[model samples]
Target: MFNDGSHGFSAQVSTSGFNRRRFLGGGAAAAAAAVVGPALLAACGSNAAPGSAPAAAPADDGAPATGILRVSNWPLYIADGFVAEFQKASGLTVDYREDYNDDEEWFSKTREPLSRHQSIGCDLVIPSETIAARLHRLGWLNDIRESRWPNKKNLQPGLLNANIDPGRKFTAPYMSGMVGIAYNRAATGRDITKIDDLWDPAFKGKVSMLSDVQDSLGMVMLSQGNSPETPTSETVQKAADVVREQQEAGQIRRFTGNDYASDLAAGNIAVAQAYSGDIVQLQKDNPDLEFIIPESGGTLTMQSMVIPYTAENQKAAEAWIDYVYDRPNYAKLVVFTRYIPVLTDMTDDLNKLDPSAAANPLINPPQSTLDRVKQWPALSDEQTKEFASTYAAITGG
Candidate 1:
């Protein structure tokens, strides 16, 4: 079950070296299910070494069933046909809803629903990186059960070390990517490589940005040489100043929650601020839409597959989680979305799935560019609030 990688996805490195970083599952996790054993899942398969799905395993129903796993996400994040495939393969119906608008919206929903044990009414959900840390800290999520996810080993080290889910104990890496800008090459005669470019006269009333506090402000701070790792008091104030200025200058055409894509596509904005994955599909559909990182830096993030504490179908949910990372599936996703795959070894499988997709730099970047990107630190609640207020004033929102 995959959507060619969209919504929020990214990779992260850590103080520690590779190998210790943990990968909890591979695509088609059924292949790795045997290693995790039934304790982590329903335990209907024989324990062979690993690497193959159990034949006639209880998890593979291959027909639609009655129960549902309400999957919540940002609207139009994943490609079509995935829910159908997962339902067809596992025989479980999906009450898939696009309720996650932004970090704050999803965080609010989870806190209220999970606090009363109302389940957020969704068993599996995807949350952006910074919020993932918050969800894990708030104790609203489930713990990682390696046995339930036999394919965990295939995950890349960068994903393994994300502080958001530290060790990914509560969730699996859904998709890993960056947040940057997308523009129409024909409209913005200048190539956009720096943050100041968004304010260029050419993009006046033609630039768009995310409606979130973390990324919008974080990008501004990075452009000013600030690491989002822990925004100092002065740095925080400076970021707010930048947002206020941008809004006052009429530089931003509009701030968006999810409609950022539509605005960019309709030519409402010539240069668009966006997540690399979000604009990937738009680029394919509209050749004029091209994306670039700001000259200073970009905000790196990871969105993950988390099983809420109130999940009713943990067994089936675990089985399906594995399906997202299996080698073949992982390879398939890299092509459709054009976001770099966190798993390095996927080149072969990716080529097999689609040669042209593999060649797209947006899908698989050259090693040099990947090295320059960095993950922003999760700001404390105070920081988030301060930035949001500052940005609202700047964007006149």
Candidate 2:
């Protein structure tokens, strides 16, 4: 259930039993090399196995929606009581499963079934934006009719029309976290304020960057005054050069995933490219470890909810989405998950529930910080390959 190198959607992803630091020790390079491949991506846009007819979307069999609404999400993501409360409100059963860990792993397991137009045996699933974009392109998800969900009005205006799922017709905002520098105060001997701090000679050979190409490279690009919103060969190369120079100079100890949290917490590394949610949790044990969104900018990584093309219970899926967006329920989720809340209106209530969370810039960054937060653009096959290959080379994959 550890999502260390999996890609940051939130801080809650890096934790004890599923520490990213532990996963990195096994084989950081090997893991990065195989995170995604051409063979798996080939399954993306096909609706059925080759030579077979594309499977039809599941029909809405209007029998009073009674069966369990199956949901696949990351491990330990949801709040303790939300499921039971949701069940009570809707009079439907929930078969929520934490079967999704690594994005590639989930895609591999379900691709053939989805490609063959067969059910992956779930009504709703959470996939990071990058993977979700693949599912969207493959025409494998239900068009989330926003008009039906009254609570959709409560969503932050910016998220309503994502770059990948314009108008959010196929995806709904679930959870999000910022990617930035997390450093142990005692180790760094000073507060780290920007992405450039990772290169400080004093902390050389005691720093780590995420192995995830997008998080590491994208953040670097922002530091150099480039925007990932309209990425190109030149901008990406600029970012790659920065990473390579540090690696070659021995300033970077290793390319990490969520495992950076473990190293930073143990005082093994001074500064690490870290996720906001993970550092929030880590601080409970070691207050000296601070997560910062650089003064210049940072990336806002997100995981969104979507209904697979093969799912039959579309109504139930929509109901669940609407149910969670309701302010009261969402407040509970924000307090429990410790990720950035998409409901802009719930800030006051959340502050009342957990003042510390509201105060933490990582969880609830100020207006200026939010303005600088940027989401990764949806990449085509060529762009994806280029960035991945470039990053893999630096990691020695």
Candidate 3:
């Protein structure tokens, strides 16, 4: 789930691997996923009214017995004892697998089964918003029945009823972050503010963009006064052209995954397209590294949870969603992962766990920063292929 188009777990985690101590100590970016376009997930939780108290699960009303609850998510993305807590509370065998590493890869494994309405082995799976959107469109996911998710009331307003899964009937956010710019202050010798700063001659060949289209081209789109939120092939092509010009002119050093972090920290690159969570973690090692949501705007993204159509443990799956959404439970995640929690009021609680993590602007950006962020729009399969090809070509992948 944390795997963006350009980076994988190896790139996102520390060199020491998924060591809990090092992870909590601030490892790689560890963000859940990338951006979605305008209203991409706008109505995802459409069934639930924002701020409404959660309702009891069907188990309370004598729902059928459930078997083991199988959940697949990104490695090390959640808190240490998250699975244990859920198991203890629900008294259900929880089979949690952190094998979901890439959107495209996971989709390939489950697509055929899901398309045929067959079980995909896991009861619940977390995928990036784009994958979730595609699954919902194919009728492969289950709706998150609100009556069993009383904690739904706490989801930040912006994430509720997202357009991708309106009424959140088919999906719910697992974790979210922003796409922006990260720069080496020492390398640039100046503060960077807007997207245009990336194109400055002083930083030529010292700047990098993401290899993913939703990130690199999306930001480029914003800088060019185009909206990725409602992208057509034409709009996306235009954005791709902008990046091509830079690549051809040798303005950009290279398109990268999270490996760009090492270069930026080492002053190998002065400016790079980056993610909010990654910058926050990177700053623990180098205070000189700064992340900015360009004044023109940035992109907001999330990795989401969805149940397979053939899932046999719907109650347990929904129960897990409710459990995580509970303020205190969610706060544990905020402290451990250092990613922005969708439940907005947990800052006070998070402060107790890690003061620095609680106050970091990159982890908890202000409303002003959020206001300038956009999501990637939904793309048809043909459009997605076209966009992917364009991005690959420009990056020389």
The lDDT values for all models are 0.61, 0.75, 0.71
Model 3 lDDT tens row, 1-397: 1223253322444421222221120111221121231123233323322222332223346463356899988777778788998888888889999887666556656655554456787888877787777666655566777777888888777777576755676777877778899999999999999878988999989999887677777777888888887887788888888788888888999877666877898998999988777776677668999999888888877777888767878888888888888887887877767676777677787777777767887676676777688877556655666677767777765
Winner by lDDT: 2
The candidates, ranked best first by TM-score, are 2, 3, 1
Worst 10 residues of 1 by lDDT: 12-21
After superposition, which runs of candidate 3 have C-alpha atoms over 4 Å from their true positions?
1-67
What is the TM-score (0 to 1) of candidate 2? Answer: 0.86
Q: What is the lDDT ranking, best to worst? A: 2, 3, 1
Query: Which regions of candidate 2 deviate over 4 angstroms?
Result: 1-45, 48-66
lDDT of 2 by residue, 266-300 (tens): 78899998777777767766889888778878887
Give stretches of model 1 more than 4 Å off: 1-113, 118-123, 201-205, 258-268, 333-340
TM-score of 3: 0.83
Each prediction's TM-score versus the true structure? 0.69, 0.86, 0.83
lDDT string for model 1 (289-390, tens) is 887777777766566777777777666677677777787767755554455677666767878978866776666766565665666555454544555555
Span of ten consecutive residues with least summed lDDT in model 2: 17-26
Per-candidate clashes come to 26, 5, 32
Q: Is candidate 2 or 3 superior in TM-score?
A: 2
> Which is better, 2 or 3, measured by lDDT?
2
